[model samples]
Target: MAAGAPRVFVSHLSGVAVFDPNGDQVGRVRDLVAMLRVGQRPPRLLGLVVELSTRRRIFLPMTRVTGIESGQVITTGVLNVRRFEQRPTERLVFGELLDRRVTLTETGEEVSVLDLSVQHLPARRDWEIDRVFVRKGRTGSAFRRAKGETLTVEWSAVTGFSLEEQGQGAESLLATFEQLRPADLANVLHHLSPKRRAEVAAALDDDRLADVLEELPEDDQIEILGKLKEERAADVLEAMDPDDAADLLSELPEDDKERLLNLMQPSEAADVRRLMSYEEHTAGGLMTTEPIILRPDATVADALARVRSADLSPALAAQVYVCRPPDDTPTGKYLGTVHFQRLLRDPPYTLVSAIIDDDLQPLDPNATLQLIAGFFATYDMVAAPVVDETGSLLGAVTVDDVLDHMLPEDWRETEFHLDESDEADEDNEEVAAHDS
Candidate 1:
C-alpha cells in the first residue's frame, strides 16, 4: 500500500460506469487488467477492460483514469477506442484473483479470495494489489448453516493456489459472476473466449444460465446451447421466456431443435412448439406463453399474487389475463386482461373480470409484425394477448420482444445501432421493477 494513493476494491470496480470529462458514460468496467510480476511483488495494474454500449470490449490504461468516486470511474476524455486483447503476461483481477483459493500465513488455514483492493502508486503511473479479501470456507459452504467470515489481509500474507489442479478451472470466476445481474453477467460471458464462456455457462444453474442466454446475441446463444448436453440444454430452454426459447430453437437445425424440445416438460414444450409454428414476423412468434393467467372468477388478490411471483417476467407481470376455463393454453377462451394497476385500485375480493379491460382488443396469432406494432401504438400497451382462430388465448406479445424483432439482424455485434429500443426496454424493466 502506498501513502496518498487512491484505493478501490476490485469487486467495487466491476460493473462501475466509466464516464468521460463531460460526464457522459462511455462504457462499464468489466474487469481490471494487471501484469503479473516476478518474486513477491503484486501484479502491476495495466488498465481496465471496458465494455461499450455496442458490447465491444476495449482497454483503458490506468494512466487515463482521472478520478474514481461515487460508483463511477472518470477518465481523462482521451481513450484508445481500440478493442482489448489480453497479453500473455497480463491477468484479469476479477477473472483470476477473486474467488481463488489462498492460504493464510498465520493459521495456515486455506481461504477463498472474495475480493482484492488495489492502490495507485504514488508519483508513478502504476497500481498494485494492497489487500486481499478472503473467505474462510470449504467448497459449497454457502449452503451450510454457519457461513465463513471474510477477512481482509495484506496481499503478501496469502499465497494463491492453482484452480486447474484443484479440478475447478473457472469455477471461481463463475461464482463471482453469480452476484451480477443477468445482463451484466451476459456481458462478461460475451467478452470471454469461446471455451471459457462454455465453462462458465456450464457452471450456472438452468434458470440463471437461461436469463444470461436470453441477454446474449443469437449466435452466442446457439454456441453455448450447443455446448450443453441435450438434457441440460432442454432445461435451460424451458426456463427461458417462451418467445426467446422459440427464437433460439428457430435458429437450430430441425432435428436438433426437435430433440431438445422433446427433452423439455410436455407443457413447456407445447408452448414452445406453438410459438415456433408461427412465422418469425408474426405476433405469435413474438409472444411469451407464460403470462400471468387466471379464470374470470379469480379475485383481485389472486391476480396480485400472480403478478408478484418472482418467476414471471416484468412485462408478463404487468397484467393478468382473465380467461374462461382450462387456465393453461388454449386458455379455454380469450376473455380480457386486467392490468396490475386495476388490481391495485380494486378491492382484494373483487373478481378480476369485473375490472378487466374489455375494450383492449387481443391480437390474432397470425397478426403480422407491422400489425402488432400498430396494435401496440394504437393501444399504447406494454403487452397484448394473442389469440387463435377459435378465440383461444395463446400468449402475450410484449413491447420489448417486438422491438427486438424490429431491429436489424447482427445489431448486437455491430457498433452502430439501428435504434436504442433495446436500451429503452431495459429502462422499462427497471421502472416496472420499481412499480411492482
Candidate 2:
C-alpha cells in the first residue's frame, strides 16, 4: 500500500469490546457494517453496527464511532441497553431519512446534510471528551446544538445532502466524481469560491480532474489553472486531450504559458502547439490528438496484435481507426473505424477495411461548433474524425467535449440548493432516478 492510504481489512470488528462514556464494558462488537453517505456512493462512511448481548444488534451513526482501538470501541455517549432490544423501524434503516435529507424548521426549508457532528470521547486523554469533532458535512454551525434536542436523534434524522446548493456563500464545493456525470460535476464547480474551487480541484484523481477541466468554460478554466501549483497544473494539462491542453495554454499569459509548455514532454508540447496553431473554435483546434489509428491493409489479427502491444489511453473506447499508407499522406489518409468486438467476432484473416465502416462521417478542419453539434446529433457519434484539406486525418472531437459546452454557468449552484420542502421531493427524485 502507498503511504497515507489505509490498509483494508487489517482489523475486524469481531472480538472488540464496546465501552460507553462511563467506561463500562457494554458488550463485544460482533461485526461492523457501513453504508455509503447520501451523495457519496461506494465511498464515505454512513453508519456502523455494534452487536450486544441477548443476540441484539445496536445501530450507531458513523458520527457515534468515536475511536477504534486494538480491542475496544468507544462511543460519544452512554446509551440505554434496552434501545438495542428491539429492531429499529424500517424507516430508520432503509428509507430516505437515513440518506441525510432533513427539513430545517426555522425556514420550513430543506437541507441535505453532508455529515453529522458528533462528540468524540477517548479514554486516557487530557480531557474527558475530545474537543475535535467528527462530522460528515460542514462543521461549526451555531444552530447545530439547540437546547433540549437530543444530539443522537438529530444526527440520525439526516437523509440527503446538497452539493452546490445551500447558499453558503459559495464556500462549499463538491470535489469528488465517483457517481457524478461530467455535466453534474461542471455544475458543482461553477458555484464554489476560488479557494473551494482549488480544494475541489486538488481532491480529484488525475482522470476525473482532467474530465472536469475539459468540461469547464474557457474563463473558468483560466481561473482554475491560475490557482493550481505549477506541478499540479502541469500534471492536469498532461492528462488532458491535446486540443483542450492547447486551448487552456492559449488562455494563459505568454510567460506562464511558455513555462508550462517547457515543463511538458517534448512530444506533448509539440502536439499542443500544433493544435494551437489553428484558429480557435475550429475542428482542428478542438480535436484530440490521441486517435486510434491502424494500417488499412492489416488483417484483424494484426490489428488486434497492435492494439494489445500499444499503450492505449484509458479514456478511449473499443473502436480503432484504420488509415491508408503513410507514404500517401504523412498523417495517413482517413479511413474508417473498426469496433474491437466486431473484429473479435469475425475471422482473424479478414482485412481491417472490409470489417470497418467506410461510410463514417468525417469533420473538416475548419468546422464550427454549431456544425459540429449538428453532426454529433445527426450521427450519434461518441467521436468524429477531423481531416485536413488533403484528406489526411489530424485528430478527433469527443462527445464529452461537446457536453462540456452544453452546461450553463449557474449549473453548479443547482446541485447545492437545498430547501426544507425540497428535501422530500429531491430524495424521492434521486431514488427514482437511481432505480431507473
Candidate 3:
C-alpha cells in the first residue's frame, strides 16, 4: 500500500452512520464485502452491506462512496436499495472474517482474527485488504483474551482467507486480466462466448463492470445486462455515466427499461429519465449529468480541485462550468465556463467568474448532431455547455460523445483488437501457477 493511501480498520466502521451529500442519513454500515483471491493475494474490497433506516439491507458499491470521515460515511446519494445477496465468491468481513482462526506465517502460531484493514490502491478507486489485526492467544470472548498479545501485521504475514491454490474460474480469469484497461477488457468480453462473458461480468465489481459496459458494443451490453439479476442490473446502471446508462436503457424493451429505472435510486433515475426525454443525438441526450460544476464565486483553486478529481474523464475535466447557485446540473442560471488553461493562468485566489469565457455561445439542448459537430470544429472546443431555454445549465456535451454518434454504429466492435500472444502468455502463466 502507498504511504498515504486511505486506510481504515473495519472495527471503526462498525455501525457508522452513512449520509448522503445533502446530509440526510441513509443507513448504517453493517458489513463489508470482499472477494478472496488465489494463494496469498490480499482480497479485493467489493462494497458495503448497509442497513437502511427502513430496516432494509442494501449493498452500497464503494464507487458511490465519497468519504469515510470520523464517525460517519458519506455517499454520492445514488444508492440501490435492493437487498444485498452474497455471491459464492463474496465473503462478509464482519460476519465471516472476524473471530476466525488464522495462522502467522513466520512462527506458525494460530490467532483469532480481530479485525482487517482495507486501503485504497494508489490512483484508483479499487481497495484491498492490506493488513490484519489479530490476537495471539486462545480464541474466546474478549475477556478471555484480555491477557493475550494483540498486534497488526501485513496481510502476507497471515495464512487463510484467500481462495484455494487450485481455484480456477471467472475470478481467476479476471486475475489474469487484472491489469487490462477497461476498453481491452471489454474487447475480451466481447469475443468470449455468451456464457463466459456473463460469468466474467458477474465476477467484476460494479464500477469495473460499468466502465466495461460503456466500452462494449450495444448487443454485448444488452446481453451481459440481461444476464444480471434485475436488482444488480439497476445497481450497475446507477454506477454508469448517466448519459451512457440512459442510452442503454433506451435500447431495452419499454417494460424492461421502466422496470430497471424504477429499481434505481430516485436521484440517479431522475438524471437518466431527464436525459431519456431528449432526442437520441441531441446535446441534452449525449451530455453527462455529473460534470464538474461550480458557482461563480468559487475560486480558481476550487475549480482546479474539481478538475483534479481522478473520477473525471479527460474531456469532462477540460473545463469547469460556472453557474449561479445549485452546483449540480440543471444548475442555476448558466454563468459561463472556465477552461482549465484559464484557471492555470490566474492566481489561486482569483474568482472563476472574472475568468469566465462567456463570449462563446453555449449549445442549445435541442442542437442537432451536425450542429454540435460544427460547433466543436468551429471553436476547437473539446467540450461545450448545454443550456436550456430557461437558461439553466443542463450539462456539457464532450467531443468524444459527438464523435460516438457520428461514427458508424459498429465502430466499437470494428476498432477493438486483442493481442493473442498476450493472452497466451497470461494463460500459460496461469497454468504454470496452478500446476505447481
Candidate 4:
C-alpha cells in the first residue's frame, strides 16, 4: 500500500453516488476501470464507468475525480453524455476481480475473494491495489448456517490473481466480459490464448456466443467454431442471424460445412442454404431470410406487436413486409412494404395494405452489391426486401449487413474513437457557458 493514502475497498466504491462541484447529483458509479500492468507492479486505476440519468454508461477519468468518501464521489462537475467503450488493455474491477478464488500465501488455503482496496500513491496521481478482503471459512454450526468472517490483508499476501492467472480456466474469470458489448468481447477473445479462448467460448451461452462470433474476424470465428462439438456448434449457428451464419459457413470447407449444416434444424438449414446459393456479394447472399413479414389483410395492431419483439434489430423493426396468403415465405404475392411511420399514423384496426409504401421498390435477388448500395442510398431505407422472379418475397437486406460486407476487415477498431480528456473539457465548457 502507498504511504499516507486513504484506503478504500472496491465494494464500498460500487453504487456510490457521484456529485458535481455544486453538490448536484450526477450519477452512480457502476464499475471501476483499470489497466493491467506488467511484472510485480499493481494494475493502474484508469477511471470509473458511471451510469447517468439516461442509463447511458460513460467513462469518468480519475483526473476529474476530486474526492472519494462517505459512499459518495465528488467530481470536477464536468459530465460527458457518450457511453464508455472499453479499450484493449482495460478491465472492469467489480465485474472481474471480486468474488474470485485466491490462495493465501501464509495459510496456503484457498479463500473466496470478497472485495478489493485501492489507494492513491503518495504525491502521485496513481491509484494501486492496497488490500484484499477475503472470506476465511464457512460460517456455520452443523444445522445452522451463517456468513463467513471477513479479513482485509495486504495486497502482497494473496497469490493466483495476476494477468497470467486470468487464463487459468476458472468460470469466475468470465464474469468480467459479461457486461461488455459483443464487439468488445470479441476483441478480448481475440487477444486471449487459443486454449483460454475456447474455455471462455464454452462458458458463454449460445445467444451471447453467437453474437460474439458474428463480431469476430472470419478466421477467429472458424477457429472458435472448430473448438465446439458438432452439435453445440450447430446450435450456436442456429442462434446466429441467418446472413452471418451463411457467411461463416461459406468460409468453411465443403465437407465441414455440410456436416454442420446436417446437424441444424431443417428450417434453419433451409434459410442458410437459400442464402448460400447466391453470390457472396449479391443481394441474395447478404439478405436475412427471417425478416418481419405480414399478410396484406393483417391489422396494424398485429404488425405493431411483432415489431415490439426485443429480438428484432432497429433496422429490421423499422418496417414490415406485406405479402399475400401464407404468413410464412414463399409469401405468395409481394405487396408494398409498410414503414413504421405509417404504422403509427394509421389506426390499430386499419389493414396494412392501405398504408403500404408503394414508392419503395424491392431489390432483385441477383442485384450486385453496388446496385444494392445505390438502392439504399437512393431510397434512404434501413432495410429493403428481396423478391424472386415470380415476385415472391424472399428476405430483406439491412444496412448493417451491407456495411459488414463493404467495410475493411479491421474496421471494428477504427470505427469510433473517444478521448476522456477531450470529453471532460467539452463538459466543463458547457457548464461554464450555461452559467454565463
* TM-score to native of every candidate shown: 0.80, 0.50, 0.59, 0.73
Candidate 4 deviant stretches above 4 angstroms: 1-101, 112-115, 123-126, 133-152, 162-177, 191-196, 415-436
Candidates' C-alpha lDDT: 0.79, 0.56, 0.81, 0.79
lDDT of 2: 0.56
Cα TM-score of candidate 1: 0.80
Query: How well is each residue in 51-143 modelled by candidate 1, as lDDT tens digits?
Result: 887777777877778888888999877655545777766677776666567788788998877678888888775777778887787644322
TM-score of model number 4: 0.73
Task: List residue ranges in candidate 2 displaced over 4 A.
Answer: 1-193, 196-208, 215-220, 301-318, 325-330, 406-436
Instruction: Extract clashing residue pairs from model 4.
Output: none
Which residue runs does candidate 3 get wrong by more than 4 Å? 1-168, 416-436
Model 4 per-residue lDDT tens digits across residues 1-436: 2357478877777567899999999888877888766654677787788866544567887767878977899988876665577666777776556655678889898776767888888788667776888876542222233366778887778776753454333243454445667876786677555766787788788998999999998888999999999999999999999999999999999999999999999999999999999999999999988888998789999999999999888999999999887757657898989999989999999999888987767999999999999999988889999999998999999999998889887665342444556445556542322222
Q: Which ten residues in a row have the lowest lDDT in candidate 1?
A: 427-436
| C-alpha lDDT (0 to 100) for residue 126 of candidate 1 | 70
- lDDT by residue (23-88, candidate 3, tens digit) is 999888867888888877898888787867554566787766778877898988866654456677
Q: Each model's RMSD to truth, in Å?
A: 7.7, 16.6, 16.7, 7.9
